[model samples]
Target: MTRVLRAGVAGAGVFGGYHANKYKQASDIDFVGIYDLDIERAQTAATAHGVAAFDDLDAFLSSIDVLTIATPAFAHAAVALAALEKGIHVYTEKPLAVTSRDGEAMVAMAAEKGLVLACGHQERAVFEAMGLYDVPEKPLRLEAVRNGTASTRNLDVSVVLDLMIHDLDLAISLAGCEAGGLQATGRRREDEGYSAVGGDEVNAEVDFENGMKAVFRASRMAAERERTMRIVYPSGTVFIDLLNRKFENGTPFALNSDFAEADIARDPLGTSVFRFLDTVLGVRDRPLCTGAEALQALELGFAIDEDVAF
Candidate 1:
């Protein structure tokens, strides 16, 4: 029988709870419990999942072979570093860290320890299902829009980190090269109650080293949820409606509709979790989303947030 790896969560809140449930459903892993600053919430979440809650961070870290850090973006680096130092495989939610420096540290430690480190950039799975990765020609231009109604979730950072980062990751992946630089403008927040130091609505134009260009617009104060992308190549264009979970290939390449229901349904978190576990267990050749990749995306996002002046 394949050994079931012990898995635990670092936060008992929104994404943490979601991840806990995923761990329960995944057959190769045992849902151990959660560790959080709020002991009560952790205990409650643990009870709901039929697992033990930990008030003691060390105890929680010691008990699990894999720790998924679904804490706030700012806290990711610290929690990831602790778990990585303890030789535990780590997977963190997106926008790896508030700062590129912290993100780089997490990636470095994972490499040093030879432990699997993955990021929760789930949208890549959507593209994978669309066979977007197999598009023959490099994109000359790309456009992305990711908007969602105001929510109290992930308010620790601006809309760029919370919402736009997803599209930014995708743009970079499709561009398939390092970014040269970018130009951006953003609003702090129209919703007074949800504003942060990091702003909420942002639009950026990125120039890639390989001559591909991308324009990304993300807003958390949107009236309706939207997630869409368009990639332009010499031959034709590819348009993907992420929210609708389908794509239209204006190009000649025969893109497959052979994707599974879950993939097409846009619940890539399950796929992301599966990939993370596979990487940790050495069953997968490589991570679908790596710490370093997330770090690069974070760096670009910060640049957009801070470098508005050309």
Candidate 2:
């Protein structure tokens, strides 16, 4: 019989609640508790889920065999490092960390400890649903646009990390190569008292080592929400309406026409969490997104922010 793992979420925010729900629903996971610096917030979430709440970080870490870090972007590394040191598997939400250094440290520690470290790049499931990874031909050029209406969430990081990082990961995964060069420009909305501190809009072009040119545009100050991608391959082009879960595939390869109905694509967050648990249980080789993969995405996000000309 497979051993049941004690799983906990290290946050009480919206994403944290989502992770907690996954844990609660997992058959092989013993949904442990919720941890947060804000004790009241933790209590509220834990109570809602009928689990314990922990204000002390160490106490929280001690009780769980696996941890899902839904903490703020800046706190991800610290929380993950602490959990890894205690021999706990960790699954961190996207962008891995605010900086490449912190992401590297978390990945290195997970490798050293022989523990699973997953990232919440749930969008990967969408590609899997569409069977994009099975295509042999690499993309010649890729374009992604992700925009969001004004919101107070994820203000601690720039739009590059908050929104663009998803496309960056997809672009990198599809390219399957290192980035050779990048150029970027962005504008912040702080002057307008929008509350977000860093870049509110970013446009970046990346040249991958495999000769793929990827363009990314992300905005947190958009009038409407939009998520779309266009992939140009040697054979033809594939356009995706990510927000609406529809696509127009022009490639010769057989892509799933009903990908939207697939469970993996429909509920990526649940699939990601379950995959992490399965990896921890030795039922799978890896999660939907591993630490190294997330680190690569994070490093690219850092590059875009640093190379911003305005």
Candidate 3:
């Protein structure tokens, strides 16, 4: 039997708690506990899950060999570095870090320590399960839209980091190549004040070395929710309405035709967690999302933010 791993989660917010629940339900995990700036919140989650609650970050770091960081974007690098320095495996939520330099540093630290450093680009799992990578040919163009109603939740970073990073990571995964050059433009929501901290809408066009191109649109100001992607290949088109949980695999080279109605919920986060465990347990050689890949996405996101007209 595989040995159980002791695990801890930093941050007690929605995503942190969600990660905690995943650890609790996994048979290979001995869920150690949680930590948060608000000790009360940590205790509440700890009590509910029957795990230890730590008020001190160092103590929490000492308690577990594996950690999931669901903290804010700006704090991801610091926490991940600390965990890696302590020889702890880390699975952090997306954007890796607010700056590319920090993302690079985190990646370097993990490499130095030989720790499993994974990022929560969970959306990649669903796309992979759907076989988005097996297109009949290299995509001439790829398009994506991920928009939703405004929320105060993740305003610490731009929409490019808060929301667009998902699609950007997916864009890289589907293209299966490094992006070359990109041009971008954006504006904040009209209703917000002039000093608003982050953008509400953003757009970018990325060029691949092989002459393939991809365009992305992300907005947090939409009245409705939508998450979709359209990949154009020589054979045909693959259209995915991620919000509606449906996709039309229009290629003549059919893969999974009934994917939309396939009863299984598209729970990529679960898949991401399992992949992290697999890496830590030595069952897999690499995580689903590596630090280098997350860093690449962060670098591209910063490039996309450069032309923001707002």
Candidate 4:
């Protein structure tokens, strides 16, 4: 029997708890323990998963073959680099690092150590289900919107990083072109309690060298949550309703056709963890989102932030 890989979680917040549960449920992994700056949160998550909780980062790092960093985006580089330097495989949540410099450094470290570094851009699975992974021909235009009511989580960053990055990552993956240029505008709401970071809404347009254009919008203070992406190619268009988990395809832009269910509902984080284990066992070729792919997403995010002024 193959030995189950031991995994440790480095945060106990919402995403951290989710990672811990995924590790516990994955057959190929042994959920070793959890760690957090907040001891109580770590203990709570560890107990819920029936694993040990360690407040010491070094002790936790020493116990697992893999580390899942689910902390805030600003802290991703510091924590992940520490683990990578220790020769532990790392799976970090999206917006890999706050800046391109940090992201490049982290990627370099992982490559130097020959360790697997995966990002939490699980939306790629949705693209795979939509058959967009094959990289369609040069897209004439792309429209995307991801909005949600203010959630207390992950508000330390602007909506561009907090939410729009998902669509940006997806757009970059599907367009199969480097983010050569972009222009953006955004607004910040100071009275909304978390506006100190930036505005509550961001709208931007990205132009690829291949003549593809992508328009994206993200808002954290919307009346209702919406996640949708529409891609228009020369031949047909593909529409994804992320909120409802529905996919639609139209050639000649037809209407009234019953769209087929994609059934791509497996938990993405869980799927990510399993894929990481497959990498460890030499059963998979590469991680779903490699360090380079994540760096591209992060670079696009920074460009959007820089282009847009509140």
Candidate 2 lDDT: 0.93
- lDDT over C-alpha atoms for residue 40 of model 2: 98
Candidate number with the higher lDDT (2 or 3): 2
TM-score (all chains, Cα) for each model:
0.95, 0.98, 0.95, 0.93
lDDT of 4 at 119: 91
Write the number of the candidate with greater TM-score, choosing between 2 and 3.
2
Model 2's TM-score against the true structure: 0.98
**Alpha carbon deviation, residue 262, candidate 1 (Å):** 5.9
Candidate 3 shows a clash count of: 0
Query: TM-score for model 1?
Result: 0.95
List residue ranges in candidate 3 displaced over 4 A: 190-196, 260-265
Point out the worst 10-residue segment of candidate 4 by lDDT: 255-264
* Residue-wise C-alpha lDDT for candidate 3, range 72-180, written one tens digit per residue: 7778988888889899999999879988788888889888888888999987767666766665578888899999887777888888988889988988876778889
Output the worst ten-in-a-row residue range by lDDT, candidate 2: 189-198
Candidate 4 local accuracy as lDDT?
A: 0.83
lDDT, ranked from best to worst: 2, 1, 3, 4
| C-alpha root-mean-square deviation, each candidate | 1.9, 1.0, 1.8, 2.6
Point out where model 4 deviates above 4 Å: 252-264
> Which segments of candidate 1 are over 4 A away from where they belong?
190-194, 258-266
lDDT, candidate 4, 42-137, per-residue tens = 899889889998888899998988989998888899989989999999999988998899999999999999999999888776667556665446
